[model samples]
Each structure stands twice: as C-alpha cells, then as structure tokens.
Target: MREGSPGWARLALLALLGSILVPLVAAGLRSVLWALVGIAGLALAAVGVWWTLAHTGVVRAFGVALTVTAPVAVLALYATFGMLWPALLSLALWVLALTAARTASTRGRTASGQAVAEAPHAPWVLMNPRSGGGKVGRFHLVEKARAAGCRVVLLDGSQDVTELARRAVAEGADLLAVAGGDGTQALVAEVAAHHDLPFVVIPVGTRNHFALDLGLDRDDPTAALQALSDAVELRVDLGYAADRVFVNNASFGAYASVVADPAYRDAKAQTVLKALPGLLTDEDAPRLRLRAARTSAEGLQALLVSNNPYGRAVDAGHPGRRERLDSGQLGVVCVRVDNAAQAARLVRGPRSPGLIRLSAEEVVVEADTATLPVGIDGEHAALPTPVVCRSAPAALRVRVPRRRPGTRRRPGTSRASGAAADWPRVTRLALGPLLRQRHQARAGASGSDSGSGSGSGSGSER
Candidate 1:
C-alpha cells in the first residue's frame, strides 16, 4: 500500500509472498522433506541389501553405505540407522530454507527476519506449591511471565482453579497458562476449553511429560514463554473421563490402586520403590479381567493408557519417554501380573513395558471382579467400573513451538523460526453447571421438537 516503505512494502510483500509461496513452500518443503526422507530410506534399503548379502560372521557385521560407496563394517550396522530417516528431517529444512529464499517476490525484499515477541492475552499462571522439590520458589517464573505480556495468577494448591480460570475467561482473556503438575495442567485445560482460549502449559511440576512431547524446554521458562510468541496454536485432541480433560490418558487397574491409596500422597516414591522389588522379583500380581465395548479383550494386571501410544520406552518410562501429542487417538496399554512376586517379574523396572497396545477412538473398560480406581492423565479419580474412554476430537487448543517439518529440532534458521500459528480468535465462556444443564435441556427440547411435526413458534398452533 505504501510506496517502497520497508515496513508496508515488506508487509505487502510478505502477504503476497505467503499467499503465493506457502503452498509452493509447503509443496516444495514437503518434497525436500520426503526427498531427504527418501534418501534415508535408500540408505536403509542399501543397508538391508548388504545385510541380506552377509549371511553371518564378519560379512554380516559390515554394511555398504547407500549415500556413499565406502564400505562400512559391522560396527556401522546398527538396526537404528534406518530409523534415522525421520530424524534427518532436520537436515532437510536448511536445504528448504535456501530454496525458498531463492524464489524471490517481485518486490525482492527479504523478511525482517527478526522473531516477533509473543504476548498472550489473559494468561492464567498456576504453580504447584508441592512439586519437584519446590522448584518454583527457586525460580521467579511468575515474574518473568508477567514481563512477557502474561496475566500471572498463582495456584494455591489447586483451590478453585476452574472458578479462577472461569473468571479470567469472563474478563476477556485469550490464554490460560499453568506452571504446575499434570493435575493442574488438566484443570487449566478444562477452563481453556470452557472459554475456547489457547492454553499454555509451562512444565514446572515433576517429569514435565507433556512439555517434552511438545518440544518445550522445562528447565527454561523463557523458552516456554517464547512458545507463547514463538509457536503456532495446535488444536490438540484431549482425552475425557467423567467431567475432566486429560492431555495424557486414563487407566483402570494396577496403577489406579496405587494412585488411589491415600498413603500414595506421602509414600509415592517409597511405595513405588518397595513395590518395584516385588514386581521385579515375583511374577504374580492381581490379574483383572478386562473388557471394552463390544470387543474381544484380554486380562490385565495393570492397565495404563496414554493420549497417544507412547514413543519407544526410555529413561525408566519417564522424562524423555513421551507420546505423540497430535496422533488424534488414545493409547491403550494393558498388562497382566498377580501377587507381589508376579508383579515383580512382569513389571519392567521403573518404565513399564508397553503391552496389548493399540490406538482406539473410544474404549469402554469394565472388570468382572472388584471395582477399580482410575488414574486419568496422572491424576486420580474413582469410577464404579465400566469406564468409558473416547477421543474428544480436537477439544483443546495449546501453544507449542512451531517445529520445521520433518525434524525434532526447533526452527531457528529460517525467518519462520519462532513464528507462532495465527489462531482463530474466539470468545471463551466457562460454561457453568447451571448453564451446562440449560444447554443440555435445550438440546433435549430441540430433539423432542424435531421428533414431532414442528413449525414456527406462533404458527405451530395452526
């Protein structure tokens, strides 16, 4: 609109460039990603060819490199080398950046290349007073968040979070952020969905499981804060049990019992440690019959489910071991072990083995014998058995760093680095129990009306 002013021209150039280039960029980058991925496949294929040629002994040990003619010895023949294709996506991005930059707009001006500051509206910051050795006290994360356009609020032991969040949403807030445990994370998510605002998850609690999944840095609140300004809003699917929302998953049976134990609050570490000896030593733990809605099922000693089927287990199943957050499915994992002896034998150390695993849209679980306590997304709850599990189908919107396609590394090389997604700005309203009931009533009334021959209000009498 302006005559060659760098600001307006650049804006116009970017708008035009984005419109013309995004698809082309998407297509081109996709090709590069697939190309690098394909190269990786070729490399693996070449290895597989070599592995096939080598029947055994020393020949089996060495393999030929696909990209290079140089022969590799058995030292290089790792099964994991093939999986590097996906990981190599990071390399493909730099190539893409160069290519995209080469195709210039007629305006010929490059992006300002400066990462913009992320200032979220209505940020709800909740901290856990009891988490990870009280690390929040050591770090002034709240003050830092306040400095970065965040409306900071503290969580006093999960007291009235839904209420506090509901109030924030009512006051025209656009983001709900939590710096606490998974329990607090899910609670904040509930209010975020209630108001339909973007929820920022700052992992201050123990493990920071979901944080790792989103490629966020738990140790650095600034990186998490940068996520507010740096990444796009992904409408991630949330798992629901009863009235609560779960970014992780829900399980009934073994872990449920452990979580439900009142002493678990105090003896979580000790109890787990004590239980580990028996679980590893003995091969017997309580065997529970498992059933899902209208599906053939098996018996499990301890059943655990994640929002997404977790990635290959590492770090005793905590920390680095995180599930795919955007799979649009819930992961169901079932295990069988009875008695302390059997549990010891069946349980695989701290990180449990994934068994009877599958991604299902919905699951209805019930047991034949005793009622089961349930653990939903690392939070405890009680159900009378026959618990229902289903995907919420894009219910929660979260802010996560925009990663370059085909790689796990954060986008830093291109102008698009730290570019958050432009989310659809929507109004947030915490649907009160009364309002929720009214909404249900309206639906019922509408259903009844639809069942009958209904006309316009006044004219219906005729």
Candidate 2:
C-alpha cells in the first residue's frame, strides 16, 4: 500500500491493536499474566547486570548468574505453559506496528534549509589522513579538493588545528572545512564562526554524528565535495561547554571518567566496562548538580548535553540523532540509577525517575569537587566546576551539498524525542482522513434534505 494513504494508516492502527490482542486471544488470560512476569524478570536481569558491573567477588558472581538465568527462566515458564510462540508473535507484531506507525506519522518531513547563490571564492580544506583509518588517503581527498580550486592542508599530528584554521582565515580563506572527527570539526567550526565564514563538513570521521545529522552521506566522503559548486547553507547551532565548543555533545560523570582513562583510546569497550563499576560505586566521587531553564537536578551519575535535542525513538534506526540543528536548544539527559530497584524501573522507559530528559537554552553543571572530567565531542578534558553548557543559536553557517542522502526523511524513521510512542498523535494521523470523509458525508445529507424541503414548499405555494 502507498505510504501516508488512508489504507496505510488503517493498517498501522490495526497492526498496533493486534500486537496486544493476539497473545490474549491465542493463549487466554494466562498469556497476560505471563507477560507481566516476564517483564519483571527482565527488569531484574537488568539490575543484575548493573550489579555485576558495580560489585566484585561473590556478589558479582551472583549477579552474573542472575543475569544469565532470569531470561532463561522466563523462557522456560513460557515453554512450559505452551505460550512461547504467542509471546514471540506478539513481539514481532509490536515491532512491525511501531515501524508502520512511525512511517505514517513522519512522512514528507524535511529539515529547514535555504539555497545558497554564491560559492566560496577562496576555500581552505583540512584533511586528517588518520581520522577514519586513513580515509583521506583512501579517498584521495587532498588531490580532489585541490583539483576543485580549493587549497588543501593535510594534518600530520604536529600543528594545532585551531591555529591552522586561524592561519587560513588570515590568509584570506572565505570558507573553512574539515575532513576529520567531530572534535576536529568543532575546532574549525569555531574558527569559521568567529570569522563568519561558511563551514563545510567532509564525513571522513569513523562516526560522523554531525555529518549524519546534516544529511551528508557518511559512506561516500567524496560526495561532500559537491558543496563547493552546488550547495545550501544551513544555519546550525553550536554547543559550548564553558569556552570550549562542541559540535555534538558534552558528557559528564561516569562517561567522562571512562573517556579520561588512558586505556580508552586503544580499547574502548573494555575500558568502559572496567571503569563503570568503580565510577558508579565511589561515594567520594563528585556528585553533580544540574540547573537549566528553571529546573534543577542533583546527584546525577551521568549527564549528556547535546547541541540540539536528539530524536527520542530508540527503534527508529537513528538513536541519539537530532532531526534539526537549528532548534537553539540543548538536549539534556541525566541518569541517576542508584540501586537495583531504580535499574529495574528503567523498563518503564522515559517515565522512570531514574532518567530525566529535557531541553533548555543553557545548563550549568556544578560538582562538589573543584574540577570535573568532561568528554567534549569524544575528546576528554578537565573543566572547572560549575561548567556552563549553552546553545549558540545560528552561530555557524554550514554549507552542505544541495542533494544528499540525509536531506529527505527515510520511511520508517521518526522525529519523536524519546523511546515512548506518542500514541495520541499517531491515532489522529491514522484516523484523520476517514474521520474527515464521514463528516463530509453527513454534511452532504443535511444539504440534500434542506433542498428537498424548500422545493416541496414552493410546489404547495404554486
């Protein structure tokens, strides 16, 4: 069926209803009870996993055992009761329904942008050969950029990037661009913003989160080169943590501590897993208090402040992705899972008190300690407390290719802010056309009756 059509909407609504009802109809009331039990078990298992990270010795072993056995026990209960098939079917239908609902609601949505008439006369591009496993060398970006009438600077790890950007600006560079990670991107972007020059992004970074949000093709770094000839300028916001600018986000608490570890660069996952326990349990560790937009939160274990609010739909294939960069607001997510019960409650998603998600124009992060370890766009740094993170609305002008992959919203994607579905909005969208048609039919009938009565009266008078 065609997307955004009445039929598609009806199908989505039906699928959503069926995802809940099918289990009950097939397996009776026992299925409902079993499902609740399963959810609780899974929540407990999550708590157990946290325990395994935060504890050592016998308690850790118990946590490991519980984590392994809880889900298995739930499965065993389902198998014993002959409800496994129905449970699996319900889950599959739920996923399908979510996908259909998201598509029906968010179709035809696009980011706000304006056309750029003039191209930069003197563009300077920086290429980091080691950024994404030597993407510059593989793509031959330096040669391509120079051939396109732009001056190219290849970074060799010695010279500071910010200084390089300033030097380029002094030498009459009209546009500044980077072919590196978000940290490097932020540096050049800041320089470009300071000089009021257009900034371009080449998605040569391993995970170009900034480029992805701008709708640039991450797979093809060369595609970004088209911005020089044919482009649109997007006035996007930049995030600042104190004086430092971040293109993506500033992370504090547990995550920042992990990033500051010496072993993180060589072994990231292992480092995080090893560090989480100590960070979570250390009482003397600096407790953070966050204040923003008339709301305040304290005792936060982890906090993430982003340049723009990220899309909330976890299943939309783009978690931690921002739909628009021009919102002029910072996305703040604070986590404070203090105990097993709090960890278990996370199954409620956004409703859980353990997680606080909000948006504000500015945020102040104060800690009990004199200094706070922060991860700014994946780079680690130490900042003095009460660190201030604020949005620099329309501070940087970004020139992107007029035609790129991310410019259009893909089907099955959502712009929702969190994991929870906005069912009310979905319902309205799903039933809107049908409701309008019904109202029109009733109005037509009323008009026909009025006309008929008037005709009879005129006949009698004649």
Q: Mark the regions of model 1 whose C-alpha exceeds 4 Å error after superposition.
A: 1-119, 269-287, 292-295, 313-323, 338-354, 369-371, 402-462
Give residue 192's error in model 2 in angstroms: 1.2
The lDDT of model 1 is: 0.55
Please provide, for model 1 over 173-219, each residue's C-alpha lDDT reduced to its tens digit, 9 standing for 90 to 100: 87888888777788789888766788777777787766666656677
Residue by residue across 255-344, what tens digits does model 2's lDDT show? 899999999999987898788877888777656899998899999999999988776613345655775687789999898887888989
Model 2: colliding residue pairs: 312-416, 312-417, 312-418
Residue 92, candidate 1: how far off, in angstroms?
A: 28
lDDT of each: 0.55, 0.84
- Show the lowest summed lDDT stretch of 10 residues, model 2: 411-420
Q: What is the lDDT of candidate 2?
A: 0.84
